[model samples]
Target: MRLRALLAERLVSRGLGETRDTRPQASRLPVLVPVGPQEDPVEAEADMRRRLHAVPAGTDLVLRTSGSSTGTGRLVAVSARSLLASARATHARLGAAGRWLLALPAHHVAGLQVLVRSVLAGTAPLVVDTSTGFRVPALADTLHRALRGRDPVYLSLVPTQLVRALQDEEATRALRQVDALLLGGAAASTALLSRARAAGIPVVTTYGASETAGGCVYDGLPLDGVEVALDAEDRVLLRGPVLASGYVGAEPGGGACDVGQDTRYHDVSLAGGTGQGIARQEGGTPLWRPGSRLPVTLRPGFHLLPTALPGELPAKGGTGTVRVLATPDRGRLEEGRLVVLGRADGLINTGGVKVDPGDVEDALTGIEGVAEACVVGVPDQEWGTVVAAAVVLQPGAALDGAAVRRCARELLEGSHAPKCVEVLDSLPLRGPGKVDRRAVQLLLSRS
Candidate 1:
């Protein structure tokens, strides 16, 4: 109910009371922390209230990313402007802001955005009770009830949800009726996307993170104000109003970004402003053009980590006049559309050679009967780190470890081939259905 009340404030004033005329008299506003579906809601809300002073003023929502993906742990601070910008952009893209069905956890940006859209549209969002877990029948039943009105209803989900939904005829048919079904949080396998489309489900592949206030790009195209660019090393750079204000430290010892301090690891000749499809280098020099590769240089300064990740890439607010996020993910422009490869941090470095697991996974999935694949780097005595894989075969399909290796070698041979492959019934997941690479690495290490 408190979450809904906070969302209601978005209606009375512009951007959660950030407007000049309607500003509240409070010196510091309390940060809104969403409770997980299964968590004790009363305790979670009380905990957030107790530590209200830690969060800086002007922060609207505080969200945390899964520990499995990012190396560190911290809370993402999103301002009202960023959230509204993201929600409006989505409504504009979908052509109408109608009803929305929330299938993801409220703690996640995707699920929060669903409520935002519903609030903006003046309709209470129909939520599928996902506390126990995702069930196709519950999703189908809730979606059925949500579709009674003439207003177009929308659904947001991850790849794993769609995989299970396609198995049931009622779930698949119910999903097909949604105005637009968003698939994100993790890469959708080629086979999964094909099956969803063949089943007549409207699946729009999304690309973004909690740092960007959910997905700024939908189906290979940037949303209204969102811009996409690549730095010299092909690291994805994003800029727009959708970017979060900054991040707050999780606690005293989370090993994440420091709260209210210098977050920059190295000094860069940075110059940028708030806009679309354009980025500024030093001296206000425009350096990036859409659908083209542009290299932004980083001058040597205080280096913390050796990884190509901007050491601790400051958030849109913490940085400076520059508001771009240098995402760990790597991507390339394909015929004017962004094709994201695997994350740069997730790359397997074997024998001093860098290998992208996405390339290997894509190659493996190209083989017949291979449903999905996750490639990781397990510690090897000789190679320092060697490639390994976990695969989920298509239903009723039989495959062995050798066959999976052969398929991987056929396309990405040499150092990219998996040293050992584990054929699991399903890949392990964390958060809203992202592959748990850390778990995969641990499992492959034992084998």
Candidate 2:
């Protein structure tokens, strides 16, 4: 409620339950409630009015998460305390509380948190017109206005947006002026990170989902009062004040409720892979020996899992860190810090061998002519699922499917190479401009 007062013009509320939504039902948690600039003008204004004025006090907020690797979305009941806690940790970690440029969609956590961070920082975030979707000129203009303010400015962007920002001189110039740029939403490529650093943009890679109230980990370090751990399976686990209260049950005919105890959770872990630094007992308990294990190295093309040592857990309403329930990601421990890998669900099983699509995509994107690439598993009678890819090439560059596959073979395992490749003008995107893997698979199927 205090956050509402801070952001007078920006309304925080649940999605309007529009029929044509792209995210799965369970994954639609209202983390940072967006003002739906993409919606019909009349409808968007009406929804904003309802959230701004009609919602009663003591009314709970119901938000859905973007379904994890399992493809099932969960509805969560998040409190103002948790949302604020998440924002406070981020602001503290960055060591600066200033204006944030809201470039992401309000409907998703990354975008909504920009506004939330602004509220906690007591600063007004300059919002860009994402109604036409994220564009270079729009982002540049917003960044310029945000920088004009007295307070330092920050921006949160998905990897896709950053990629676009790097293409244009004006956008790149404006982006470089921000105090800090929080990059998350999806795993950023090494090349992308290098480019950002080269451009002198202060980029902080973040790791967290809607469940943890945005990103609990900044630059692979857990935010203050936040706890990051690994499960027996090497999956990442998060616990802290930033954690959401837990999920809510679906409505009778299919919808989410604002309040419910039927689905309160303690911890959740995603399926994780093995790592070099991991030492497990016979019965499967991880033993941590930081910096004493294998060189703390990660494979070039393959995704690695991050391991963790146990940390202090806080009591309810107490002034300590929360506990990890579970997460869908995999990562490893580097010295004392947490290192995240790609999601376990992103792994593809072909011919009884596990292959990471992320690795394949990494290989594809690294190719000279490829601007972006998304690799997915398509149903195959022979191999259970065969690797397929959708790629977007840079302007004036010509790349055939054979060249794409050839590039993957050079960087990835033969099995990891795409069995089929589809060249497109652009990759399909979903929530907050993240690549839509499901939609990419659909494109592969159609071809």
Candidate 3:
């Protein structure tokens, strides 16, 4: 609390309130300890004095976060310029920027980007306090307030919040008022997306991490100045102005900028205008651009953990259409669009056959009585890791484990079938809308 107060003043004074790193620990501000609301004024001031001395004279804004893929934390020095570049690219893709309802926690990159966008748009974000907890009424109220203004309204949310919002009639109506509701954090199930679209919601699926300064790709296509490609291992690689400078105490490619070729960057333009295309392939996988080799030029973007590439690369000779082969969980690029498969880590291995939990979860959700489902790999002596499912049945609906297993087996391979099903009131969630996969596995383990 004391740290935010001290850092907030320093940032606002420098017009960096929307862009600077606010983590005192990463910044080495040991004096600014966490304080409650009732702390004495004198003590707070003394702490502030120490903090002022600790902060270097012309320090750049550095935000620190744990890598979503690797689970390792690092400090990222983000510049006001980089924030603006990211914001501009998003706005260019979304068409306009106006009043934004800040629903996410202010500490994370997703939440901070809302403020950054507001700053770039010369508007204040209508904040939805999550201290009490995220509720549909709170989101609706904040949206109502932001909509009263003439400027366009935007909202950001995780899948969990969207799910709750869809359940409430008032919240669903409020969502339609916004120009775009950016949905990311976790992959939204097909059932969830279908429900949102059915309700006339302008929900834009976003893909990006903290390294890229929030969502760089809206609905699979990279924003202006952003480029998305695949490495030989099929890992998604991003390059653009929004890319972070690099991790604070790391080597080259260790989450920071390049060491030797800092200034030399590839001038590859977005091959197709507006970065849109279509494709038709001989066998599902889009053929490599004819006679075109992966360029040696330096394109600046962070490498993502996902191993899916754009369906069609810029080929030597090609028309607007191309086709790309897709695996079960790793999505394929098709008709110039990237389809995201669920997390690769979530794949369940049973008896030497790999089963995508999402594929099984999709099947479970499609069942009449199942409201939601989360599948995890449970340790089994015979199969190595058997698939287990935690299911949440709809209100007033009853389902048996055998029925769910039978239905899944019908739709999926026998190895992909769940060995056990634990019906629960609700699946455990770690964040706003992310299912606690680890917790689900633990729950099934104990059961």
TM-scores for the candidates: 0.81, 0.75, 0.71
**2 or 3, which is superior by TM-score?**
2
List candidate 2 segments past 4 Å from native: 1-35, 39-60, 68-72, 250-323
Task: Please provide the root mean square deviation of candidate 2 (C-alpha atoms, Å).
Answer: 10.7
Candidate 2: count the clashes: 32
**Candidate 1 lDDT:** 0.73
Stretches of candidate 1 off by over 4 Å are 10-29, 40-56, 250-294, 297-320
Ranking of all candidate structures by their TM-score, best first: 1, 2, 3
Full-model lDDT for every candidate: 0.73, 0.65, 0.63
Tens digit per residue, CA lDDT, model 1, 1-447: 457668657534543432346654444445677767677978877865664445544577788777656544457777777887888899999999888898988788888888777776778888898767888899999999988889888989988788778878999999999989989888887878988999898888999888888988999999998877776778777777887766564453222222112322333433333221222233433344455454452211111121112223334544333445667678888776788986777788999999888778877877787778888899999999999999887777778889888877777768998988899988888876677888888899999
Better of 1 and 2 by lDDT: 1
What is candidate 2's local distance difference test score? 0.65
- Model 3 compared with the native: what TM-score? 0.71
User: For model 2, how does the per-residue alpha-carbon lDDT over 134-244 read when each residue is reduced to its tens digit?
Assistant: 788998988888778788889899888888888888988988888899999888877778888999999999998776778888988888877655644566756667766
Runs of candidate 3 exceeding 4 Å displacement:
1-77, 250-255, 258-331, 400-403, 431-433
